[model samples]
Target chain A: MSISEAVVMNGGNGPYSYEQNSSYQKGVAAAAMDMIKEALPTTLDLYHLPLSSPNPIIRIADFGCSTGLTPIQAIETIVQCLLDLIKPIKEPRFRTLEFQAIFSDLPTNDFNTLFTNHLPVRRCYYAMAAPGSFHGRLLPTASLHFAYSSCALHWLSRVPQEILDKSSRAWNGERIYYVNSPAGVVGAYSAQFGRDMEMFLSARAEEMVSEGLIFMVVPGEPDLVHDSQTTLGSELELLGSCLVDMANEGIISKAKVESFNLPIYFPSEKELKQVISRNEFFHIERIQTLSHLKMHVAFPTPESRSLCLRVALEGLLCHHFGNELIIDDLFHRYSLKVAKSLFFLKPESHESISFSV
Target chain B: MSISEAVVMNGGNGPYSYEQNSSYQKGVAAAAMDMIKEALPTTLDLYHLPLSSPNPIIRIADFGCSTGLTPIQAIETIVQCLLDLIKPIKEPRFRTLEFQAIFSDLPTNDFNTLFTNHLPVRRCYYAMAAPGSFHGRLLPTASLHFAYSSCALHWLSRVPQEILDKSSRAWNGERIYYVNSPAGVVGAYSAQFGRDMEMFLSARAEEMVSEGLIFMVVPGEPDLVHDSQTTLGSELELLGSCLVDMANEGIISKAKVESFNLPIYFPSEKELKQVISRNEFFHIERIQTLSHLKMHVAFPTPESRSLCLRVALEGLLCHHFGNELIIDDLFHRYSLKVAKSLFFLKPESHESISFSV
Candidate 1:
């Protein structure tokens, strides 16, 4: 297939709606924001610029900004950190700073919520909506000072239609997680990741100032590529099993779903570093695995756990699988299996944390 | 442009003839073989099988096994490792072992050398050469036990012509190397690395057995991605500067040269792991940055360094500037620069090394 065809097939238009309205996505964004909050002091230190300094206006952009909350949360954290950092420097130091924030998403994304419900009231932030894929050119050269993206890089533009076509077995008739998935399907997904990451870093390198800092928070496994027992892998297996059971029951005809594939790819920390290191604009400031944080929110209670799974299903599975399957039956099976699976309920021994300056 | 067009444009008989034909490739093959030798004892320890075990035939393949000694060295290493491991074991253990090694390269590569030079010696070792791009599928399901590739994987099948077309200044007459170059030309190389690595690991996962091992040696930087002081980065800058100089002198017409780009990519160890970990079949038993090793071989001496630059000029520059400039001013200037620049002659800190399984 040509890259153009591949782009059209894998572009983030379909199934992405899951992330658009997903409560789990919101939680993930919030957790990501918390990490951004912790890193902001360091980010400011590395950039060596006062957030409140009015000497020069600083502009920030979030590519693949999704619903814009990810960036909103990130900006909020940055502001809080700036406030904390400037508190000791006196009010005079704070009065000299000027900041501007830009939130970007696909032209097709709903921007009403961002403009109406989310923009911070007190902060001096301006919103400009960009309506194109970040995988290509998104911003002008050296136009951004700080950029942030969370929980959205993994979704390819769209699942390849070849994989989604009924004649193809590459899809295997379900929206399973990545592990134990077909090789071609995996290749397609990985290729999309490779392209997306390349587009991301290249664009950022050109758009960011020499010392600009880019902060990214996305779902990941530390070494899941090598070890299938990792949380991401197990989650994929669980999803696959659920899909397989549905296929076995005749609830969903195999032919209708044979080639259907999801556009998700959760990279490990090593993978993320590889992507970061290749661009050479961003340096590793820190990396933290927030899976523990995710686990905390995901498994707080049985009701919460159910809500989390429901969010996951609605955001990830339902987005891909649609409401065609027996929701109750599929949900019951998925919930029981996920509850028993340590990957879903247990907090990993390590927290996912990472920083790049 | 479609992938088919990209493949056709990037895919050719093969580029890099000097290294392809030089003892350097032989050395790379030997070094890879040495890694296999050292790891063989452990590999046997894990498998508890003898070199001659017939119960499960030891099937091995090398992805991107370019027309060099990688496969020959790997086969030799594996055979020697297995034989040495079993020499002290019981006869029953030895009697049950059988081994098969497959060497794969692009359909355009010269496989005759692999068959005639390497595979003839061992009666017990079965050898077969397959023609296809390793980045695409080339093996049967669960058909390989051990896979090894070195240096070659870094080279995408061909440089993406879209970036090279004169209309696109992406190459700026330097060709795809800057686009694909690990350093200096553009950081987009990282994304390319990620994509190539993803294809590599995903393809291998399906080809490898349950307990398969893959040992790969690739060029990489240990520091964060943004550091441009690395040897690879310097080399790219040198090349880019040289091209810019050529353009300034009007030795090469800007429009003709700007229409094409270089296609080359080198990855860091972190990037390699990210690629490998994406697939569950292989675990990273060990990873080492062999920048020192590559540096040692890449610049064996001041004369060798000059020769390397000359080759680059001839292979890459001559096409744009024409033979007249290459023979007259380009060679002399490049040679003089090489002689004057103490840094090129200095023992490089970043020598290429092997990352073993």
Candidate 2:
């Protein structure tokens, strides 16, 4: 399947929906709000927005916004901050200026929930939903004033071709990720991330106005930490091991495990910085590393952790494996394993890297 | 129920969805396309649209667009006409202008089906979905350049209150619409349509630029035609009789039928002209009456007509009567009645009224 058709979070507000399981992303937005407020006046130059025009309309967009609850809080903060900043100005047109919030995601996104169920009752912006992939262009050229995204960029446009090819050295046999796989597998994932980032940055450059500001929160690994030492890496490895355990008993096939790799990569700050700097279209204002350990408070039990992971990955896993019973059995085994792996990885693996451009 | 929540059609591509049952609306749109193409150049002043601005973007909106199949065709024709008109002009900036299409409907609309399945594989405009009541402000002030709607304006914001008041002379105790009702009931329906159109026109005026163009295709009655002589009026009356038939047999209560009324009104050309003239924000360029009889080709059999009507009104009926079995039984009875109503209405009942402002 193409990347756009997959990679969708479970939709609607049911027990396993992305909406019900997205509290960690909400915490990520809350932690990043202070940086968003502090950086806007310096890097964004909010005072000179298009308040002088006759329409005086400002556009702010959130890309890869799944069902829009996470982006709603962040966008509300940005709009409220802008309104408060311009309150002291005597320009009547500044007071008349309005904001248009664009909530964008893949076309398969559940926009009915986004617009009807998640939008605030007393918000101060006109809401619109744009449905398309974010890896390429979605908006009009040079029409965006502010662009924001969170917990979305780690998803590669597609999994690496080399990891799926049996003849390649990067063939990830019996593994679903590059946790302790060969270096060639890691290199292939890193290369795919680089290419996707180039496309993402250039597309944003074309969509944003010359003086626009962008804020993003991405899953990332620290430069000195190994992949298997992070929380995300350890969890993925635990789940892959459980899949192999099932395959051994004929519950699933080994070839299925070898062929299905997660289309995700945790880039280091150094790697992300190098890509942004090479593009020459945007200057990285700051990269803040945040350990999102507080989010674990919402999922204290192993069952809760397993449920969150299931809600996030159940859609993709079902698409690959085509059996819900096997998935249920694997997650049950995986959660028990997660309960005992205290020495394998550090809690600092919950790091989220945020930046302004 | 609130107008924003209750005006929705049946969602998704199920057997009862509005998407599959709305071919008559498509025919209404196609019938209006010729007049749309002929009226644009002289009335709209399309050549001078923000072509020289740094970020040249033109926005077009469709209010009351259910799942956007009807507007997709109309919007494509409009964009192609604009592109062809600008091709002969020797200005480079005119070629740089882009179009943005906004599809507006009630909050409960099925936007997932709209943006995912109905959008063209290749189209010129960037598509966006706006969810809210069109009777109030939705877009930013003066942000719209063109506005369009077809077969949608006849829907009132809500059912008229006088029709539900027990003591009022206009109370429609046994009927669901003003067909063959008393003069007081007809007057009450007309007054409600006038008020709803006032709110609709003023909201568009605030959202549209001074030079923007507005086009609408509304279900309408000729001045000489009686309420019992039109297809829509006769069909609605037939359904109401079906409800009364069930109520007499104790299948449902009389109070439930007494309190229920369809939230719709079809105005005469004289009434529409008077309302538009009183708004003062827009000038009516022309009003052309069209008989959309070709839509019958798609619904030749009584069963086909029954299914189409069921898909269009099942949600509203189920909400009022609160039983799916009753709705199915009502439609079953009404379809047989429609097949026998040979002397009640003429084939000319299939009329649509279009106007440009």
Model 2 clash pairs are none
Best by DockQ: 2
Error of 1 at B159 (Å): 4.6
**The CA-based lDDT of model 1 is what?**
0.55
Angstrom error of the Cα, residue A110, model 2: value is 0.6
Summarize candidate 1's per-residue lDDT along A1-357 as a digit string, tens digits: 112212211112233233333455566667667676777776565335422222334667765554434557767676566556766774454554545565655533434334434554445543444434666555544546778777657666666555564466655346544566566656556666766787777877876667777777677666644533345546556656776778888777665455445566777677777776776556777776663245545455444444444533344444445667665676677667766766544655423332232
Q: Against the true structure, whose TM-score is highest?
A: 2
| DockQ, every prediction | 0.01, 0.71
Q: Estimate each model's TM-score.
A: 0.42, 0.94
TM-score of chain A of each: 0.71, 0.92
Error in Å for residue A332 of model 2: 3.2
Q: Give the C-alpha miss distance for residue B321 in model 2, angstroms.
A: 3.4
Runs off by more than 4 Å, candidate 2: A50-52, A227-229, A291-295, A323-326, A343-357, B1-3, B50-52, B227-230, B323-325, B343-357
